[model samples]
Target: MQTIETVVNVTSERQITVQLPPDIPTGEYDIVIVINESVKSEKLAGEKKIKTLKFSAYPVGLVADNFTFRREDLYDR
Candidate 1:
């Protein structure tokens, strides 16, 4: 018994192709598939939103060159 999990995009209305591992010898095996259209759409929307985000400078007084403290300076001497 072996289990293989992978993601495949649908190229057509009701067709999806999955490539099996070569190690698994050719033979009949149980297959199962689960679809989550809502999740996939949400992921795409989130990616788009992230891409449109605006970039700005850091907070006041936190800019570069202000990081003078060393890693060992956080503890008591």
Candidate 2:
């Protein structure tokens, strides 16, 4: 996969202008956009902040310690 790094300006219309490298051949490619939090702009002031959670692994140690209950314990009143 070819990685191209460039800065894009977000217009007043809430659209980003991305310019692909000229050396890149014409073909469909997956695009991933990441915004830097350090770069503040007035355009983002009105926009609502979005909270995102990153992928996490299950706590195997915690589950193992908590899974000591017997099968009958689950069905008991």
Best by lDDT: 1
Task: Return the lDDT, model 1, position 60.
Answer: 81
Candidate 1 residue-wise lDDT, 1-77, digit = tens: 66677777877687898888889888777877778687788888988764566789776863466565676755676
lDDT of each: 0.75, 0.71
Clashing pairs in 2: none
List candidate 2 segments past 4 Å from native.
41-77
Clashes of 2: 0
What TM-score would you give candidate 1 relative to the actual structure? 0.46
User: lDDT score, residue 69, model 2?
Assistant: 67
User: How badly does each model clash, as a count of residue pairs?
Assistant: 0, 0
Residue 28 CA error for candidate 1 (Å)? 1.6
For residues 50-73, what per-residue lDDT tens digits would candidate 2 score against the true structure?
Answer: 566899887656455566667875
> In model 1, which range of ten residues has the least summed lDDT?
62-71
Which portions of model 1 miss their true places by more than 4 Å?
Answer: 37-39, 47-77
* lDDT, residue 33, model 2: 82
Please, what is the TM-score per model? Answer: 0.46, 0.45
